[model samples]
Target: MEKVSEKVRQIIQPGEHSYVFSKYLEPIAHVKPGEVVEIYTKDAFENRITSEKDLPSQILGDYLNPQTGPIYIDGAEPGDTLVVHIIDIEPDRDWAVSVMKESFGGLTSTDLTPMLQDPLPEKVWIYKIEDGMVRCNDQLNFPLRPFLGTIGTAPEVEALSALTPFNHGGNMDVPDTKPGNKVYLPVRTEGAFFFTGDAHAGQGDGELCGVALEISARVRLKFELIKNKEIKWPRIESDSEYMVVGSARPMEDAARIAYSELIKWMEEMGWDKFEAYQALTQIGKLHVGNMVDTYYSLVAKIDKKYTKLD
Candidate 1:
């Protein structure tokens, strides 16, 4: 009798680094619930800022970000959903820090820095967790929930508008994309061109400074299909809730886009417009996805109780 084979596969190519995609490969044999798969990822710096001396070039040149893997999963098709379970995230280094350059950071014109006095290879920032609060420097402390600042797929064109999360998921910086969370992205092409980058050691809601801890990461994802369900934008289901994530030019407009998408979700779950609005109104809250990008993103989460049919 022939033995039944387990469907396990690795998506990324070996020993390759920075700005290159793994050549097309066969899809994973099968993906079932409770199954897990590990993915190797490159740091957001993309091997540009390896040493203290290499930091200057990292900020000045390199106009854009490069990501990896648009891995196609078996039995995944358009109008279906892909469940990306983030089981673990381990960084290569002990500490990760980000420095905001004078002209480049999100707060480009604010009084963020006292003065521009010196030029160093890179700036330094630190953190302290005490009394259940996470603090950067001495003034800011947030409940420490670190996430992937940049996790998305490629756009139709190779060179997407730098710093935006398009239909094909370029730079959607959602803080809730943390460990033990599941990010569901819409599949634009035959094999969803998935790319994961911008792993942060820690971050705030907006990533106001324009960067996260900026480190390399190790992650595991489990892909599953949501059949007979059609979603227009990215939707996520974490341990406790479901959210519709969308992006647009202005912040307020972005929030509306996300909210509208969530309404679609409500309708699909058999709620009328009034019922959907009421259900969402009770549980929905908007998130400032990423303000620094050219076009910002907003995610609307409809609490699990609203969607769970028991």
Candidate 2:
């Protein structure tokens, strides 16, 4: 086991696009898995909305979604697979606030009265399990599954907004981010600058509001490179006995994208196409990872025990 210590983490600066790799990725490449590295990340609002204690007329629109790092892996490169195994996520606390009736949230109802810009900058209400259940509103009983809502790097030649998940990963709200899961992201740059931020204490499929129970947390990730196997998008495998195929697009399109990839994967594993399709419709389930991102992503979870892996 590597010694556990807090590294002086930096927050991805505002107005910066295409996080430069040579500087950030080089350092993290040296750390071993099981070694804890504490990262400092900004809230999605990126200080646009201050603490819930006070409300503001307008939030700073520029510095939103400042992810932590484009941390480079030692042997990572384009056409290679960067596998990140999550060891643990220690959120300073287990709770977050959600604002209903906002400009881009799901709780906006036609009949609900709008609150003034001074009604507490949209409170992110959180709850504790004082009685064996995490109590939110009287009716809400949430199961905690803390995850990094945004985790990706810059695309090859452009400054892709952190708001979408392409062949390059970005704000993907796949709930499989819980501990003990490994995510395989395709590398597009020499170092594969990886940054992760926007943590959620607990959330459901399709982060309808484009947010989750927001919180600050520390993540332990083990990084390794799979050389020479080219992949297009992101894939996740977990001890939960499932392999996830993720794609970004409209819901239907995303499903088609993920499903198509699954078919290819099945064939690569030597399975019949007809049987794979049959199994997909019958036993496989499609999960809406996040819909609010510009290009929504759909994830299909395939049970590992039943599928052959090479």
Candidate 3:
């Protein structure tokens, strides 16, 4: 990971953080469109629960992911679109953490999915970062794949928890929220109250255990506003694909919402509704974001070639 340079127009340190997305929270800093900014973020655990002996049930509080800011974007207003271009994400620490707590994982007897059986035993695994790889164990090492786990603009009236992912885009945990991708969020209040955090050094699809390679990070981002371009859900654009995220209960519902939103976006881009639905039926791809949060998240994606008019 390269060091942040002087070219950044603003630097938001992880001094004051928030655990909820609310229109009422005071703006940490104000930024204009097209200005580059650097944000520092803590891991999902907020750097608590360091070793195997530090049990999450004892060390952690009610909140999990601590977000950096509710950055007020100049000229942004309700019904507008906030465009975030991720420039880069670099791990701020040499080590990362992942853990399994009692009744907290997807496969375990979580509070949402109560089972009569016993919950999974708690455990912790601290991964080492070296040579651009995350050393999981002595025998396994994989390349770094950094991304933000929670990111979104505030909802108009609700003060939602940072762990919840909904229309306002909270803890989606989608690995696609990485460097080089552009995330488009709907603005529900003035200035778009943007918040982001929960840096993952790496994660697999579905974030199976309800955790990833949690790490602190320095993220570079650029903001832009698209006036009057309101989207129902968060949309992501990469060099090759266009993706939309949806969060809901009953995993299948999340999938349906994602596909529905993708089809709607396609219709807005000139494809007939039926045609877009048919096209998606033939070529759309699905990526699981998380199955362990308050609401499960799914991403519907399609290649850019399929959307071309030529």
- In candidate 1, what are the lDDT values of residues 29-140, reduced to their tens digit? 3344445655666656664664444444445454544454545555556666666777666664544556665444555543333355443224545444345444565555
Give per-residue CA lDDT, model 3, range 186-225, as digits (tens).
9999999999999999899888889899998998998889
Q: What Cα-based lDDT does every candidate model obtain?
A: 0.62, 0.63, 0.90
Ranking by TM-score: 3, 2, 1
- Name the candidate, 1 or 3, with the larger TM-score value: 3
Q: What would the TM-scores of all predictions be? A: 0.77, 0.78, 0.96
- Model 2 lDDT tens row, 156-210: 7776666556667777777876677778777778777777777767778888765
Give every collision pair in model 3: none
Best by lDDT: 3
Candidate 1 achieves a global lDDT of 0.62
C-alpha root-mean-square deviation, candidate 1: 6.1
Considering every candidate listed, which one attains the maximal TM-score? 3
Native-referenced Cα lDDT, model 2: 0.63
lDDT score, candidate 3, position 117: 96
